[model samples]
Target: MGSLSASYFERAQEVIPGGVNSPVRAFKSVGGSPLFIQSAKGAYLKDVDGKEYIDLIGSWGPMLFGQAHPSIENAVRDALSKGFSFGAPSYNEVLIAEKIVSMIPSIEKVRLVNSGTEATMAAIRLARAYTKRDKIIKFEGCYHGHGDSFLIAAGSGVATLGTPDSPGVTVSTAKDTLTAVYNDLSSLRNLFEANPTDISAVILEPVVGNMGLVIPEPGFIEGIQQLCKTYGSLLIFDEVMTGFRLSSSGYQGLTNIQPDLTTLGKIIGGGLPVGAYGGKAEIMNMIAPAGPVYQAGTLSGNPLATSAGLAMLNLISEHPEVYDALNQKGKALAEGIRQQLSELQIDGFVNQIGSMFTLFFTNKAVKNFSDAKTSDTAKFGIYFREMLNQGVYLPPSQFESWFLSAALDEAHIDHILKASRIALEKTLMA
Candidate 1:
């Protein structure tokens, strides 16, 4: 809405595709020009026009402590002082690796990458090499980055843009990536049965954020784990969105469902561009110099990323209460939103876990992507703009999850709820 942002976007459109690096950031689905942020600090994002909003997107689930936390900032500063890329090993990388391995039960050794896409891509390759199979299973609406294999039925920005499957993905790559319905055991079972021993791995967001915070139905994740075990398929938890945000370790930590492999990003980078995938030692050992399957990044485990991540992990490790606080904050916000919807007699559902949630403009329980599709996207669009006008910045799509950060206090939660009430009311009028 700001003139400066509009000017920047118009300029960017000449060079950057869609005037944004990522698709959803264009606010295509929400029907508005995206706000170009000037800066963010402690739960607030300041647009170039000097307008500030309570940031619920949280940089798409990485700003766990909100933007520019003192500790993380200091960590980055210190690391920056040591120079940038080493193109070689660094002590910070080792320290962060050890922290990750020690925290996440499934990760024996983690190889860092630059983004979630790289992490999931590498994980799949490792899975194929380890299992000696060509095909893998991925759930519908559970995005595992934009890897060619994952573009089929991908969620998040892909879903937001209404392209369930991207065009450039090769048919062969699509064939190797089997699709299943999320939270539906029968669908997964059918995939396994049909594929038989061909599925190298079954990867999913254990608590899907891409399809707007759709939680797994009871025993859904466990069923997938069992099927993977029965068929000798590696069960991979793509916790790019849920990692650390869900629990200290991830959704796996909360459920104790031991995945054969895990892909992590977002909070692990402490708001930096970083990702990691790790699993049973034997399986992970197959990556790079450790064994045969090759995956490398020049910026992998960069000093700055490692330093920030290490600081984040250390904070979480030392203060277990952060999770509790986050959960409480999520509950408060979710409950307030539900209450607002009920009071307005709006047909809406709030699916939440920990600090991640979605308010679907539907009456039905959203257990899968199909249910998620039932949301009134038009109404959601109106609500989104209204909320933005009210200074509450939410994820700019009906298909994305909003992240609550530790920086949000009681006052911030109250402000969000007040904004939600007005937004929901306005949405009904629309």
Candidate 2:
């Protein structure tokens, strides 16, 4: 007899494309049927087949305090009685906006949207409008959501499936997006020189979470900032994954590199589907009612999302020490995994920053997408399945990052390390 999850997936395949809403959720890259989760609490997920695993994905970068955190849950519950969608302004929206503006270093004003895709799309549009240019530059492996332009040379599920460019994107859109090799300043400089005044902006993940938590080289970010200033192109940091999860403000707070515009999502919504883009008041003034460039959403700042987001942000503001604790946890986990890899004599590399981490099945140091592709994905598939069997859930794909939450206690970290050691042994044997 098939498990309940298998049965549901079978049924869903009849209606939903590939029996999953998102491409990564299909588990095509890992070569298996994806687990259907029943519920999540703190650091664990209860699968439909009545199995529980310590969660490391953290709902793909939200769930900072962990799944269904009481504060966010209570905020949602409180909002439920008030209302859902208003098709208009609400107090929570204003409060959350204020909180976001205050927290993020680059953002003086912010506009809410429905998802990270929306935020990036809007941000680029605003950049184009402000700069009066059409072309935009993006890193080869930085996934900035599923917008038409971003699919070219993208990362995450796209890289996992071996389809960097999608089918439906038009030639014009493809041409407008110039891809550069990540962590290489010369490549970006070449693009800027070739395009000159045609490029409107350069959008990227400051600390790229999309291509397995690749950290910026010492001078790479600074170089990008300088080039943007020199070329008169807007610098848009797509902080969708790194925002709040890495630090109280965002990656910008840690780096002190103030971008012209910033795109944010994930942790801000408190696991709700929400996104926002913000920047200098001069540029933001050009959006919608405030200026001319148009964008709107029926449920832009829905009461529930705003309430949950506000609650989460407030929690972060009140407790700045969470960042230190999270970094320690991340460091411990990364170190433990490295030790295991060395002891087992397995060829692997672990890239980590704050709460985001990824263990690549490779011998080379992964500095960019090119280096990341050297991973033995088949071996990673074996490790993933082994970890899953041992009650620890990691991101199914090697290209994606594993997100840690504050919910993971000392025991949880130890469990992860133990499971990883066993998994590494099994992976090596396999």
Best model number under TM-score? 2
Off by over 4 Å in 2: none
- The pairs that clash in candidate 1 are none
In candidate 2, what are the lDDT values of residues 225-251, reduced to their tens digit? 999999999999999999998888899
Kindly list the per-residue Cα lDDT of model 1 for residues 1-430, writing each as its tens digit. Answer: 4399899999999999999999899988989798899999999999999999999989998898889999999999999998999999999889999999999988899999999999999999999999899999999998988889999988988888888899889998888988999988999899888989799999999999998998888889888988988999999999988888888889999986989999998888898999999889989888889899999889999999999999989988887888889989989988998888888899999988888889999989999999999999999999999999999999999999999988999999998888888888898777
Q: What is the lDDT of residue 232 in candidate 1?
A: 91
- lDDT, candidate 2, equals 0.93
Candidate number of the best lDDT: 2
On a 0 to 1 TM-score scale, where does candidate 1 land against the true structure? 0.99
Model 1 lDDT on a 0 to 1 scale: 0.91
TM-score of each: 0.99, 0.99
lDDT score for residue 264 of model 1 = 90
lDDT on C-alpha atoms for all candidate structures = 0.91, 0.93
